[model samples]
Target: MRQEKLKYLAKLALLVLMGIFGSFLISEAGLRLMNISYPVFHGFDPVRGRILEPGMEGWFRYEGNAYVKINSAGFRDVEHPLQKPKGTYRILLLGDSYTEARQVSLENTFGRKVEQQLQSCERLLPHLVEVINFGVPGYGNAEELITLRSRGWAYDPDLVLTMFFSGNDLIDNFPRAELREPAYIPRPYFHLDQGELKLAYNFQEWSPPILKYRLLLWGVHNFRTLELLNQANRVLAARHIGDSQENLSSRAGLADFVYAPPQTPIHREAWDITEGILKLMHQEVLKHGANFFLVTATSPDQIDQEERILLKERLATKKLDYPEQRLRALGEIEGFPVLNLLYDFQQYAEQHPAHLHGFSNTKLGAGHWNEQGHELAAQLISKRICQDPSIL
Candidate 1:
């Protein structure tokens, strides 16, 4: 009787284990069929601070629902040869999340659009055009400069364009001793030491644990169910920690500070560090026998009249284009071309009455650029480049 009971118990345990395994397989298949998955693309890089995981592909559903694929080179765009092809004109773009543009498909990005437009230009007909995107999310000028030196130069680009986001680049450029708010992610910062530029890799201590992180990444990459769980856990963790701290996630407070002259020492130093880094980048591009240009992306608040009014009321200021002016002034004084899209973008918004920055899934006017925004930017940039044939 005892032997018979043991056999029956053993059979029950085997059936339970098989059922669980079968259920997991079914869930994975269902999720994949629905095209639902969440994967963390960016990871800590000891050199550039953080970078997208190479060859990682997934559906990004946070702000926009679009499939994104990182190239073997870890860029959001399609891969190109390291050595420039003969009779080809290559342009390298360096910026932050706006340029990375995970919210849209690779073909719909401004970089790719510019390439398509420029290729049709009469002057550049004989020469094929190639634009490489080196943009990484959360990157500031310091990381951009480092990117150009460490990785960008390999592509042998004829021109280098830095898309400066006045919204947060100033704050991201320098490292602070301590923050009254949470430090979301640590990055390599540039500081001026005795009138010379120096890089501080303060985030080295926070580098991801290799074996454990790799195991997690592997599971997230392979299984859609695991990815969903990972995202849920992340949200819960953020909520638990965010309760005690002043919400630093929103840019509301820092956005206005950029419009005026530096109010505190940190802001003042940030401006200084930003200017210094821009100069260094300009010089570096020239040294490499390439032309450099700066394009300042319009912040969402700059185009939204209601938000503008509230910001103005809060700051009690009549003018809010200080950052653009500073950037233009620096460009002019330093002998580099600078383009400010605030006026044009604002004018378009007024006449057309459409949200260029945000998507339908997200708030209409609150986040990254949408399809229309990318199209307009491409048209404007291409027009400018063609206006002066010599620029090509």
Candidate 2:
């Protein structure tokens, strides 16, 4: 009877082991054969830190399903020359994903839309207009400045448009702010030491992890199982590490206030620091002899009265003022006109109740702007550009 029991136990163990190995083999084969790549692909850069690998063709899974193509210059748009075409008025549009706009096709992005819409103004501006999109995903103001100074001037832009999303940019610009990103990538930030901009944070040394985490970071970025585990770990960690009164001064505490909105006292310093960064960016744009325009990319929560109500209901707060107003003030003082999109976006929402300007989160119509939103942005900005002789 004892021998029979031992044999049965051995059989059960063998079956379980086989199942695990079989699943592993299947997953590996699927990854290899199916080209099931990570949503975004990137290569480490010595200067830019991490840039989308040039000539990369991959799938982008957020906002909506679409394939992504990177130009040889490591930009999201098609190839544009380093030298501006003769008699062409070139515009360099800089921002995060909204300007990168892989969520829509090449023709549908706001950058492309602006390019197309400019044709109507041939009589007004005379010269053909070309807009080069240098938008990258997950970029903060600091990154934008770096790109502008390093690569933007090469295009010899007549006008440079920087889109500022008031959602998390304030925190992103703060080096001490905690970022609970899945990959825990390092971002470069500037520190004002005695009124001088000092570089802080080394990219390679930012998150020196053990061998297991190094491998896990690769898996989390490329594979699904690891991503699930990372997200689960984040939830658990958040419960324990969520901001407390004692850690209020800590970076994690500052980032946790993303739910609290910018009007909260904890974020006052972040906004002030961000204003300085904008002023620095303005100076850089002027050095390149390009007109700088700041576009306040209003978050989904701040666009319409209905969206504002949703935030108030969820957070139970009467105050949800974002950093756009402050950014506008800084822009005014810094000599750049901030394109306030709130009034126009709200008006569009009222006029077209069925069509949406943006999505709520990562939902198809939730987090980022929808097709209609991009069109609206292009229409408004293009009209202004055509009429404003001062910009170019």
Query: Each model's TM-score, in the order given?
Result: 0.85, 0.78
Residue-wise C-alpha lDDT for candidate 2, range 43-90, written one tens digit per residue: 445455556657776776645666789999988899999999998988
Per-residue lDDT for 251-368 in model 1, tens only?
2234457887767766777788899999999999999999898899988888778887887787778767889999999988998888888889988998997888888776888779
lDDT at 285 for candidate 2?
80
In candidate 1, stretches whose alpha carbon ends up further than 4 angstroms from where it belongs are 1-35, 177-186, 205-219, 233-253
Can you give the lDDT of residue 81 in candidate 2?
A: 90
Q: Give the TM-score of candidate 1.
A: 0.85
lDDT of all predictions, in order shown?
A: 0.82, 0.71
lDDT of 1 at 320: 75
